[model samples]
Target: MDASSGNSAFNNSVAPLEGFDKDMLSSTLSQTQALLEHFNISDIEKILNMSSRTVSVMTQCYCSGTLREILLSYKSVHGYFSLVVCVFGTLANVLNVAVLTRKEMASAPINRLLTALAIADMLVMLEYVPYACYAYLVLPGEINMPYNWAVFVLFHCHFTQVLHTISIGLTLVLAVWRYIAIRFPQRSHILCSDRRCNVAIGIGYILPLIVCIPSYFTFKIQATVVFENDEMIVLHHVGLSRMAKEDDELLYYVNFWIYGIIIKLLPCVVLTVISCWLIKALYKANRRKQALKGYTNCNSASLLPSEKRAVSKSDRRTDRTTKMLVAVLLLFLITEFPQGILSLLSVILGRCFFRTCYYLFGEIMDILALLNGAINFILYCSMSRQFRTTFALLFKPRMLAKWSTPASQTDVQTTYV
Candidate 1:
């Protein structure tokens, strides 16, 4: 029976197995043991302190619960929601790429990084659209996918991950660069130069893929035959590799350490720390600006008008850029930090948590990431005046021309970040 149909069976058969009735529990345990043996499910003894037999029974009962049914029910809903979000986000990121890469905007090193980020985010959304359509929109029983399509599915899995990881890396670098620009403006020209930013962006793309290479071996395409509508059909899907199936410890460590710590947890922690530093630096800079303003007012006759205006303009631009980046970093924390924590918890809590909690909520996490990827355009539009002006100039040049004055044109020419 399909998962939805089995909800009733789950309700009736699994609820009683949770109680302390010895006879019923014993019968359920016996059946679970037989099922495990039939399926050749290994590593039960390593998961918990309980006997392998009891663990097997408990795992079976745990999976066959209300939570599973609820997750199953939401599957189609998430699929439809993700599809819409991906479509919108893809277009948004495309716009972001076009706008950020324009000559006026691209002069800023940060904008170049933003351009790379937009490309990565755009690819992520574009790649997910097809997968979402197939996996969620299409009915499983009706799916007659070719074995070769599994290659795309596999590529989709790895590619999205590599891209997302690159996004995370780029974000971290962005934060650090912004911090250096703000905290050490004197050295920023040397430290945050175009060459350095270009190298950083290249590393951001390449390093993540290198780190994710081992993960490519964790799953393989497995083909199976099924009888459908009185006809035999072959279907292919992703399954655990021989190494993954045989070496549970290796899989656990790879997931727990490599994915959980290095990819998710480490980046989240570093970003959080760097974000805090950025905020602190902004505060100090604000105080300095206030002090300088007071001094300028008192010494109005002594200071050159042009020099005073220059200082004020530079300060204002720095403040705006820092504030916008802080918002971006905050959004990243909101979306990514929880996933990192969940990854760690799933590893510690064993397969049940991994399947029930982590795997069940996978789509929700994906949608969150996609939103983060797509929402950058909105953030840039709202927070960065230069971005907005440039966007208008690019797409609505005639409209901009009508409003353009020499002063406003000069303001546009002066880089924002």
Candidate 2:
């Protein structure tokens, strides 16, 4: 087939040259040719002949012929690693949803958001399990079966994006709600009410589903014929969509601004700013608590026993909840901020950056996100006494009885966050 015909066959895959100026494309190709001069010219030409897109050219030239090998190596390692993590994460998130939704825990508005976050995370892990098995564990030669794995691949791409985007949006809402609670405790009930929280969570899911509609059209399946071992075989794979191929500006906008900015970088930046503000609020609250403690010590005779106890308990609970939430937000920042920066860099530096760095490191980013999804269970168990108590009461009644005192049980019964 000619170059244009071959390109038509795979219109749903990544096509890096769709939006570039002809002169820029020529300069990029020259640079790519010069970079690959050490390799066999015939071999490079043969690969380019298969798909003469910018992605193909850059993979060969910018990656120095190592991208495929690196992908194979990481796929083997992360396939098993990711499977284990996803399974553990899936189960952990299930437990999180269960525990967070219990009557004892459900009263808190924050727990409701946590429950939503856990559900979204669990779906992410569950969806990844089969993908890891098929993409990573299966032998390469056996991958070209009659089954339409490409469709599932397309579904996985959009499915994960939607769920993760929901997770990010919910997290932002969670942070904002916490900040309002901390900053305006008296009006928190009206501001962060259960009805409002549920509405926010609904928007979190709906907005991402809508924003990602454009992404679903960016890829499609294409079948191509090849001769191997003197036999003609048809191989099906994902390619750029017809719209993506025909509209360079749309492709660039979707990949760079929508994926990088709207999906990744914008939320991450907002989360970081909110986290800083939370930390400052926590510091101020701590100072106020210390000052109140000193004043209480000086005026011990003036205050009633009930009032003093109430004041102390309220202060402790608020401080603990704020600190725990800060930890959760920080974990999110640590895992997602690097990805945002890398995504931005990929767009800014063009296809070479994507092929040389971003694509090669994609698996690492996936594993990081999986870890983030999984590790929240550990955080809640470690940081929240109330969560531990509820979990024990539900799953280990005997242990709960063994460990509990009346005062502790009373404390645990009340909503913490």
Candidate 3:
């Protein structure tokens, strides 16, 4: 009975009655004929044409077979995949927050930004669950709840845009922080303090909220016509307000500049420039270090043990952390750029412009963004030795307890003897 095409009784129950409209139209026409002379001929013609067009559109099915297949496939496969990503991504980000918040790592400027990034990613992932349900479960025609869908789209769209913007902004800040730290080491402490970084992160979240405030008022639910099994069905769809729809051109341009430029393009441009400079600075520093190899080796014995170890460990960790962050920045750019481009096109060219390909591509870009958030922890794990060690320690406390047991201690004593 739940099947789209296999239920005969359900289809019959929804089918139109034969001669029903004809009988009603006969009575209405008979009554209208009595007042035909009172009405203008042109007005009558307009009314009939409007009715015909409305009927034609209502009886026409939207979305093609291939599009339905794609939707179904995405719902069955990607929906669950996205669910997994959100769940695991949330856990990973929680662990990232836990590990980075420890006393050992908490005070550093980069760690502060990284912690903020984890929180932002976690919020985005949490928001993804409803969005995935909207796109995959509800959109595939399994459920019909237009009002709920409209309300959720309003909140989900705004919250997601804000959270995603914050994540990107924090990343941009991180890149700039690293650039200053490496290229201008003396001023790094002054320019990139924890207070300043926190302020920047705050601005990152707040600016997006201010920018996306208009969305809350612009969207509304509209009744849309569709045909299934030759039966006309009216469904609710989310659309812009009457005012915005009337002045759609202006709205498109405004959104293109506001959402496209400020939210997406600007951060991308900043990150790219900063990333390039960071790379160049890193390369130059490596060459300089290589040139100082023999001099450093000769002077090594002249320094205290702690000082030598600190310098070596600090330099290596700084380079690794910077490189890891740069990788995250690059991956974010790759995953998110498409959605920004799509937003501009969707607004300017109209949502119906791409048809099936539009939905397919939009869904793919969304998944990519989700993937970007989901993999940040992996980047940290792979790139930072300290992160890996800390993560292991946090997750494997029982093993450490076993290593400190009396029998293991006695074994160590026997080996020393």
Q: Top model by lDDT, which number?
A: 2
Candidate 1: tens digits of C-alpha lDDT, residues 1-417: 001000000010000011133343333433543433222111211122244566556556344578756665665476689888889988998899888888888899999999999898888888878876765555232435466566666666677777888898999999999988877889999999989999999999899878876667766676645443456655455545677556654753574557667877798899899899989988898788777877778888887889878877887888899999999999988888777776777667766665434555565577788888888889999988888877777788575587765675576788585
Index of the highest-TM-score prediction: 2
lDDT of each: 0.68, 0.69, 0.60
| Model 3 poorest 10 in a row by lDDT | 1-10
Q: Candidate 2 — number of clashing residue pairs?
A: 6
Model 3 agreement with the true structure over 273-303: per-residue lDDT tens digits = 8888777777887898999989999999899
lDDT of model number 3 = 0.60
Residue 361 local lDDT, model 1: 50
- Sort by TM-score, best first: what order? 2, 1, 3
Expressed as tens digits, the lDDT of each residue in 244-276 for candidate 2 is: 667564664465557677777788888888899
Model 1 has an lDDT value of 0.68
- For model 2, the superposed segments whose C-alpha errors exceed 4 Å read 1-74, 139-147, 398-403
**Which residue ranges in model 1 land beyond 4 Å of their true spot?**
1-73, 141-146, 226-233, 291-293, 397-400
Task: Tell me the TM-score of each prediction against the true structure.
Answer: 0.81, 0.83, 0.74
Superposed on all Cα atoms, the candidates' RMSDs to the truth, in angstroms, are 8.4, 7.5, 12.1
